[model samples]
Target: MTATNLLPRNRRPADGPSPGSARTKRRRRPGLMLTLGLTGLGLLVVLAVVAPWIWGDRAEELGPSVHLGSSGEHWLGTDALGRDIFARTMVATRLTLELSALATLIASTVGITLGTLIWVSGPRIRAVGLRVIDVMISYPAVILALAIAAILDPGPKACVIAIGAAGSPSFARLTANLAASVAGRDFVGSARLLGVGPLRLMRRHILPNIAEPLLVLLSVSYAHTLMALSGLSFLGLGVQLPDYDWGQLLAGGLQSLYTNPVEAVGPAVAIVLAGLSASFVGDGLAAAANRSRRADAPAKATKPAEANAAAAVGTAPAVPDDAVLVVDDLRVLRKDGTALVDGVSFHIGAAEIVGVVGESGSGKSLTAMAAARLLPGGLHATARTAELRHPDSAALDLVAPGAENAETRRRLAVEIGIVYQDPSASFNPALKLGGQLTETLRVHLKASRREAREQAIEQLDFVRLTDPASRLRQYPHELSGGMRQRAMIAAALLTRPRLIIADEPTTALDVTVQAEVLRLLRAANERDGTAMLFISHDIAVVGDLCDRVLVMYAGRLVEELTAEDVREGRARHPYTQALLAATPRLDTAAAAPAESAGGPEASAGEPASAEPVRTLAAIPGRPPQPDERPPGCAFAPRCPQVLAACHDTPPPVHSPAPGLSVLCHLEQAGARTGETGTDKPLEAAR
Candidate 1:
């Protein structure tokens, strides 16, 4: 009853950028120069389209004065034949644009189709296509165009055919490469599992995402087509003389160069303008598309306190001396400077298994990824302090730019191994198992091929993956799910890393397989004295495997306790308590409904209104979305013990017991010792 809701009526991130965060929102404003260029192109296109009616043939016939300069009668002056250059240029644009459009159309249609086929094809066919494209790319486009033109009567039709043929292979190659990358993404894999047909996925998801790229390619390719058309015509295999296309005009001007040079330069200028216009317009569309995608991204907010982070973070706890990894005041912010992981601090000791547990979207994975220095693309992570110490090496400050130090980052990259949720996607399908697994040893250990091979097989067998020798030869897709995971762990072991960060590595496996993988992980830690940070939403597994556990809620670390406390369900936080209650119990039958007025007596004579409404207790609503997250305690809205200050002030981490920390106002109520009843001992940077 004491909890208050101070959130605005319509929930959204508060307006204006936070100080020093340099937050930038992507704007949908169109590019002014691009608009003008496109407008110019539009006018040229209209001239081409309406040339027959708008442009007068009266000026097409030869006039009395040949090679005359600009006058009232002739705007662009007289050509060598005394024909009006303005009229000739207008008609030439019609022919030039038509040829370019036709060639591009033919090329794009054939290219996209062939590319899709190549992308969807089996390895053998795809390899063949790639080779053929490579050969085509190496061969000169001009020679190919010339040969086709000579073979097909050396005319306009032949020129168009040659241009299309020359352009198709390039487009096919681009589309095939882009399609392969897009198809490999997680969302596309999800779509496939949902029974969405390949064609539907291509048309609906893949094409829409790649639309901007394809259009830019089309525009740039259109310019190429235009140049090719003019070149072939200028070489006499294209539009004939007296036809006076831009190329022919250029060709005709050579003899008169000393007298009137504009004839030659005029067509060159036109071509350059058209090429630039096309490129500018295409670039604008790509920018606009990029903005649209960013706009569609889910809204995220960095708490306002982050603007005054130095004062706000007034922290607690220090990284233990035995700590192999120490992260102080870590934050992961969105492009808009919204915090995904805010002011999270923790450490992992040598040879210790630490569990980071949270519901989905609680920033568990984000924090882990940041600590590993592998935040996903577009997400930026920073820390007030970060120092990773290896027993044999100096401490590496991860807060520094990755390139600022040479040896430290290279060493850390090899020393900290990672196991992902989906093992199959981690390995490249094109690589053999042995080659991929042995690659880690070759990189970090600098082991030779034979030595790496031996180690890889030995590690694979250690993980209990049967037929280690056979798995080494097989491709990733050839292995079963469990085999793939075990193989992944095998690869990680090859590094002999001091620390392994497993981010829900068992989530995608069957229960039996999951147990086997978890066993392997435990065996790794026990046998090698390797520290492991296991992240998962399954509290039971965390309890069974971890020495200590950290609980995250709404991007903040809310509680830290021993794994023994987790197994005993002795959590002090209401959110964790609710999570425990909601987990289904299989050792006993489900509890019966609560008694309603002692049953029989109530049914006999009691009014219906007198009967109590007996319903199972459930958490009332969903976790607040990113934009709607509470200003104070993120969990306060749902917390049964929420206090008055819980609605207005964020809580700081405090030690409730030895090696135990909780971020809750209730946990700190009795311990407020400093000014404003909100201060705590600051966490040490080291």
Candidate 2:
């Protein structure tokens, strides 16, 4: 059930596909239904356009014999007026098609506007709009059409108006739901963080993503409107004298069904065929769109920078003294006052890579997001100081209410860049790589298209992506995971911001790709002097890439130490020690000494008393949820060296050495008593 058990099972992969199994996923051609649907609609449109011209005169001609049965000259019999039923049916196509098309257009326009209104409105307005739509939808489409038609004169115009109005509610409801779903995606959130205005965001991101579904809905609405219009005409409220549709022909034929059934049968066949054409098109388009989206998505299913100068403890500095971002006492809380990130603060100096290492739900990502003012709705952040300091200008207060004006946000857009974990999800699927890459440049930097494109290519090349020009033309799904991440990095560095908040940017990558990403991040920092807040649960990665490492536990900073200190086993907090032990190393088995009569003997070339090989250790118990955290120390229940006081009282910050701070009761006492905390391991101290 665990990964270990599953790993060995997949050791020897299948040499090839089993007899019936496919080796490669076959790309399906357009569905037969889609082809048939398009073909049927094409034939219908041709009939609508040319049938009236070819059969108009003959259809209105009075035959010598009325209600005649099928014959060589007059097929499917004649109507009471002695007109050819087949000719009449063919001629009715023009009127029926035009009315349906016009009505569908009207429904789509009104529905889309109302849907957008509901989507972007405040809660009260949205609620009211939805209620009205629900009430309108409660009545059957035909019933609504009848009521509207009765209010107006009985004619084609009234029928069109009635059907279109009746169908708007369904379209509106579909559009609103689709828009809401698309708006919740991460790409939309990323665009918002980049300071894209609401209208632009909706147009460029939201509407485009929902466009295909709306198109499918358009076809369906056409079909529904066509049926409703036909019903109205059958009831004598549509296509009055001198104009005839399939419904009018059906109405007249029904009165003489017993005399000559062909009159009723012919018109009924035409109506069914026309309705089927629209329904088939809608269903086929929907299927094609779904397949295309599936193909565009992966084959497999699956922030602002804040600067705070003050460290976790007074004696130890989490960031360099010359900090670019200084956030003090940052707290991100839910609407109900639950603290997700409580009193957590850190800073990043220019060109420094400060890594935040912690287990999931430790508020690592939340802290970075809060500082950038990118927290999700219903969660607000407050900080005593979230100041972005530049050498040339006064510090900008990022946390102050009403301070984030258009100018401030525009400045932040240029000053802070965020690299998200899943690059594919962060990039807009509906847009080409080049457009998304150049958007920030055009919007925030006021660069022309040519200039933005030039800069985008340069940045893409800087991130070591090959064929940068060609990649620009491709969509996000067209690139490999590593390539997409590189493109994301390029986008982040395109504006050459002062700070980059990489929230586990390399978490989803393979080891080799992860190394490449880390290298690129380091190179960017060294070359551009762009500070970064790198967040990851991988301690080894943090040690490899960061100048300083911050260990967060639960929702607070449990320890702050230099990457060197962490590498040298000088971490004072028990959580940090456990994290270090959990990191898998190739040398773990090699360093393990052999068992002997006396005890475990040191391996050859090792000291007489070799240290025990540390097997990977999982920290027992999951991190507490925000509301479930203990009143005292959040990690007290899980800490190995927990003292009695740790259950009732919070641990005090301890400065064991310069540039090293931890929150632990033992360390605090040791610091106060002038004890050298690093002389013994955490277990020995306990």
Q: By TM-score, who's the top model here?
A: 2
Question: Which lDDT value does model 1 have at 294?
Answer: 23
Mind giving the per-residue lDDT tens digits that candidate 2 earns over 1-686? 11111121112243555655553322133366667667887898999899979999999999788988888988888988799989999999889989999999988988888888887786678879988999998999888888899999999999999888988998888777777667756678768766777677778898888888888888878878877888889999999878899899999889888887878888898877777877777787776774223211211111111211122222224555578999877877765666667777677888888999999989899999887777765568888778888888888887777675777877687888888898667788889988888987888789999999999989999999999999999999888888899988888898889999999998787666777788788889988999999999888778777899989977788888898876666677877877776676654465544534234333455576665555466667777766666656777777666777777666777766776678788765543222212223334333
Instruction: Quote model 2's TM-score.
Output: 0.85
Model 1, runs deviating above 4 Å: 1-316, 404-406, 587-618, 670-686
Instruction: Write model 1 residue lDDT over 519-626, tens digit each, in one string.
Output: 899999988888888998877788788999988887878888888887666776666665554444442232222234356643556455442332223454566655
C-alpha lDDT score of every prediction, in listed order: 0.71, 0.78
Quote each prediction's TM-score.
0.57, 0.85
Candidate 2, after superposition: displacement of residue 646 in Å?
Answer: 3.9
